[model samples]
Target: MEAEDGKLKCNCPSGTFGEDCSLGVCEIENPCLNGGTCVPASNIADTPSCICPPGTFQPVCEQCYYNFTRDAYIQLDSQVMLAINSLNQTQCDEECDKDERCTFNFIGLDGCYIFEKPVIFASGNGDLNKYKERCMQMEECLLLTHILEDNKCFLFNVTLNNALSILRLIEGQHGNNIAEKICC
Candidate 1:
């Protein structure tokens, strides 16, 4: 074939296309894996190279092969617990869910960790209803403490002591009165 300006025109070979008939079209026979795109090689006619993204590795760039899994750590104030075991996020969650004692949680590049929440249940209280009630009450107390501390109360340090004293006094005065004073 010839162009209007008399330049020679050539059809791209099967599975190839471009101005110079130099780019190879990706086909089932030459599939790209790991989500890579076919890019034309600098000097290779009708041939292309697969470009894979980070964290993914494969010959054709069709299947994603992650080099790393999710990491997790427990953050308590200034303390940071390092990764327990290397695993993906789903595995981390599964491990945490399998443990009943675990509470709050977060995921990171290393894995996942169970945040240390204060245990509200006293010894021997394994009943679900009792546990729920205790957790709710403890949450309220913690919230009150946080509020008082935020307000910069000078006696905030003694709040627990004061509460204990009040409970003792109520118990001494009347057994029924103690039950009434506690939040339902």
Candidate 2:
């Protein structure tokens, strides 16, 4: 039959045939190699062509070139961030290993950043209970000051003794001064 362009149509003699004889029927052995995708040609023939994705390049899409490694991570600021512009996992690992300060690597959308050091806290000395108690007491005292001064407590970093002295001074000024200020 005559095709839309008035060309004579026939089953592809090349062992590939489809609408208007325009389909690529690669051999069962897969003529397109190296991860190449075979697509039917637009022409009135059963021939197919290969289209390769990134990190791969070949006429038959059978081979991957160097420098196309996957994603990887690096350490940064006591955190494991991902490396930038890493193509494959192998490349990413290699890059991270090259840095002495790097402790760990992580892969993410934004690539990697190297952590120079890990975070540390004094609580490692098994004094966590004491530290927690001190912090809680400090917070409670701060809250008490806020309550006694109404919601407008002036910020200060007074020592515990100094804070008590201030409280005494306020108490001496007037019996109900603290309560009046707080309620108002």
lDDT of 1: 0.36
Off by over 4 Å in 1: 1-82, 119-184
Which digits, one per residue and each the tens of the lDDT, describe model 2 over residues 31-123?
Answer: 576567777666525456778665443455533211211121111122323346644656656776897755544444445433323311111
lDDT of 1 by residue, 1-184 (tens): 4574777777765666667765466543345555667665565444667776653334455322111111211112312122455777677667667766554444554466543333121122133234333433332322111111112100111223343543222122111111111221
Which candidate ranks first by TM-score, i.e. highest?
1
Give the TM-score comparing model 1 with the true structure, all chains together: 0.23
Cα RMSD of all models vs. native, in order, equals 22.5, 27.1
lDDT of each: 0.36, 0.37
- lDDT for residue 24 in candidate 1, whole number 0-100: 62
Off by over 4 Å in 2: 1-24, 27-29, 44-47, 64-184
